[model samples]
Each structure stands twice: as structure tokens, then as C-alpha cells.
Target: MSNSDPVLLIETVRPDDGRTESFWVALVITGVLLLGGLGILLRQEQTSATDTRPQLDLLQRQFLMELTIAADEIRFITTMNSEVSTDTGFVNWPLEQLLQEQLLPVFPGQSAKAWQQLEPGCLLLPQPASRIHFGLVLQQAGSSIHYAPADVPLPDHCETLLSWQRMDIQS
Candidate 1:
């Protein structure tokens, strides 16, 4: 054939030649492996996402427990005021130890501090005639004991208590 003229030689096609079939098989195997890896990754991510909610829930429960204990401690302090001196009273008791041992262990990284200046009773009462004040005080004390900015007055004490309950549910 001339250099410019195309050769038209007849060649027999054979199915027994291994190279072409092997290449196709390798490509299909590689594709399947990649898809399997992707599926595994997605499943692991889903599992991790599901795990986070329980952790948050455990945190909320621990916080609520801490608040309840602290409220009881406050009540104890108030009750014991006549017998124990203020400096040597229940307020001065090692609350941090109780928190660390009983509550912090549940939450892992939670930290707590009790202040002498703030009393659960103060936040509980607005005036002598406010009959609902005592219940509000108990609720608020339980709510604020675990959260920060304790001085911020709750608009509705009952609502604040409900909010904590909701947080517990969501978590």
C-alpha cells in the first residue's frame, strides 16, 4: 500500500484473546469497590450523627440533677440557719465535692460553683404577698443552678422551668 493510501487488510476477531476482557473486568471491579467504600462511609456518618443526640440528652439530665441537688442544699441551708453560723452553715458546706462526685461524673466536663451572695430564696420571693413566689423560687433555683447568668430575672418562672424540661426532651 502507498503511504497515503489506507491499508484494508482483513483481520479475524477472536473472543479468546484475554487482554480486552480482563481490562473490562478490572474496571467493573474497581467501580464496585469504590461504591462499596462510599456506602460504608455514609453509614458510619449516620451512626455518628445519631450518637450525638443521646450525649446531649445525658448532659441535660445531669444538669437538671445538679440543679435539684443544689436546690435541696439551699433549702437545707435556710432551714439550718438558726443552728449553724452563716460561715459554718450549710452554705459553706463542700457542695463542689458533692457536685463533682455525684453530678460531674455523669456529665464528664461540667463545672459548678456556688456563690454566697446569691441565695435561692432571694430569687424565689418578690414580695411578702406573692403567694406563688415560693414555688417560683424552687423552680427558678432548680433551673438556674445548672445554667449561667443566674441574676437575669426570669420573665415567667414557670416558663423557665418548662424550658428546661423541653431541653431535656430534645436532647
Candidate 2:
């Protein structure tokens, strides 16, 4: 080479192939282990859910029975919640008792200053749920439930109950 002439160096690269088989074997083993673990996790979750179903069914039944008893024995209408008219005297046993303890913890959202007639409806027991300022009247017979008017002038064939509806408030 003459003075200042460029000199080049070249390298030949080779890929390693002997260990390729071991790498693929390790990958396959890891995939199988991961899949097995995933399957076990899913099965455990399904078993837990199955166990909870029976508990949920029992809770539902107990809740229903308590509601029925509550509806059968409830009082109605105080001076703060209702007027002292004959209609007020007639109202008792609201259907809302069915969902009192189940729904609102503070069932009676009223003041204790409200007046209550010493007299109760047919089933004379302390009101189970909270006091409703205004609620719809209802009647129950065995399993049959029905809406009642402000003044129920019918025979005592069915059990009286009370419930409430939200008043439409215009914004």
C-alpha cells in the first residue's frame, strides 16, 4: 500500500444454533406451567361463587319473612305526618313496612314531636319501621298485595299496609 492509503478490516458474523433447541424447550415448559396455573385459579373462583349462592338464597328468604311480619303490624299518621281528621284515624299498616328495615336504617324520617293515636289498626303492635310523612295505603291477604285508598271502607278480609311514592319535584 502507498503512504496514506486506506486500510479496511472485515469480520464474518455467525449465528449460534446449537443451543436453540434448549431455548425452545424452556419456553414450552414455561407456557404449560402458566396455563396450568391459570386453569387452577379459574376453578377456585368458580367454586367460591357456587358456595355463596346458597347463602344468598337463605338471606333472601329470611328478609322476606321479616318484611311480611313488619307489614302485618304497623301504625300510621301523626299530627306532623297527617291531619287529625277521620281519614287520619283510619290510616294504618302501610305497605312500606315490607321494606323498612331492609331499605332505610332510619326508617322513620320524622320528628318525635308528631302525634300518634293510641289506637292501632287490627294488628296492634308498635310500628316496626320508620314513620312516613305521607305514604300510599296498601292491603295484604296471605300472599296477595294491593293498593288501598285513603279511606278503606271495606270488610277486614285483607291485611292493611302502607307504602310511599316519591313526589315529583319540579326543578
Candidate 3:
């Protein structure tokens, strides 16, 4: 294949047939398919959220029940303990240590920081939500467990609202 030698060149030509129209049609079809797929995914996501609502409600109910039981147990313990002063409720009992050893174990993922003692006899455990500015608070006061969706920040002193549901345990 010397440069000087006569080279036989073959040129291939593409005809401007209806294939160009097919390309645009395919492009439009692809776009429509992609949009449809995305719409389906969005619908499924909405459905999933609605589906989980009932489950979430059920879970909250269960959690509240467990918290009630825990509160009752703590109340009984404090009542029985000689060190604890009944005048000041949980004043003399090792409340933090007690919660760490007992309550925190039942709630696996809850951090110790999440549990706050509003007072000697009162405790506030906030139930966090994904997008809500307000949170539901589980309050344990003496022998009863109370819960409410608190729109306002919890005060230093525990105050029960009339709207709040209190589970009065006969300890």
C-alpha cells in the first residue's frame, strides 16, 4: 500500500429516508415513557405514606402503653423505697440511674438525653416527628402517665392540659 500507488476509494452514502422521523418519534416515546415511570413512582410513594399512617398510629399506641407500664413500675418502686421522700415524689430516688437501668432498656433507640426530668415527680419524654414543628410529649407524673401533642414548648414545671390523656395507674 505505497502512497504513490493508485488507491481505490469506496464512498458509502446514507439516504435521507423516513428514518429521521423515526428518530424523533422514538425520542418522544422515550420521554413519554420516562414521565409515566416517574408518575407511577410518585403515586407509589404517596400510597406508601398513607399506608404507614395506620402503622404509625398503632406504634404510638403501643409505645404509650409501654410508657404507662414503666411509669407504674417506677411509682411502685419509689413508694416502696425507704430513701425516697413521698412528700417530694421521686426526690430521694436515683431517678436518672433508675431510668437508665430500666426505662431506657425497654426503649432501645431512645437516647438518655431525650429523657428530661421536668421536676422531681415529673418527666418529659418527647416523641419526635419527621416534619412537625410540634412534638407529642409523654409525661410521667407520680403514679400516672400523660401524653399530649404540645404545640408550645414544655415549661420547666410540668403542667397537664385538659386535652391531654392521662393513664391513671392504681399503684
Candidate 1, 1-171: lDDT as tens digits: 679998889998887879988999999999999999999888873444343322234544554565456556555544555323344222332434434544222233322332212232222212122111111132212323323222344334434533321222111
Pairwise TM-score winner, candidates 2 and 3: 3
- Candidate 3 residue-wise lDDT, 1-171, digit = tens: 788999889999889798989999999999999999999888873444343222236656677677666766665665565445546444354457756666532334656567666655556666565211111223224455555543545545655422345544443
Expressed as tens digits, the lDDT of each residue in 27-67 for candidate 2 is 99999999999998888734443432222235334433443
Residue clash pairs of candidate 3: none
- TM-scores of all predicted structures: 0.31, 0.22, 0.49
Best by lDDT: 3
Error of 3 at 101 (Å): 1.5
Superior candidate under lDDT, 2 versus 3: 3
Select the stronger candidate by lDDT from 1 and 3: 3
Predict model 2's lDDT versus the native: 0.35
> TM-score of predicted model 2?
0.22
- List runs of model 1 lying over 4 Å from the truth: 1-17, 39-153, 165-171
Candidate 3 wrongly placed segments (more than 4 Å): 1-56, 104-108, 130-142, 160-164, 169-171
CA lDDT, every model vs. true structure: 0.39, 0.35, 0.54
Best by TM-score: 3
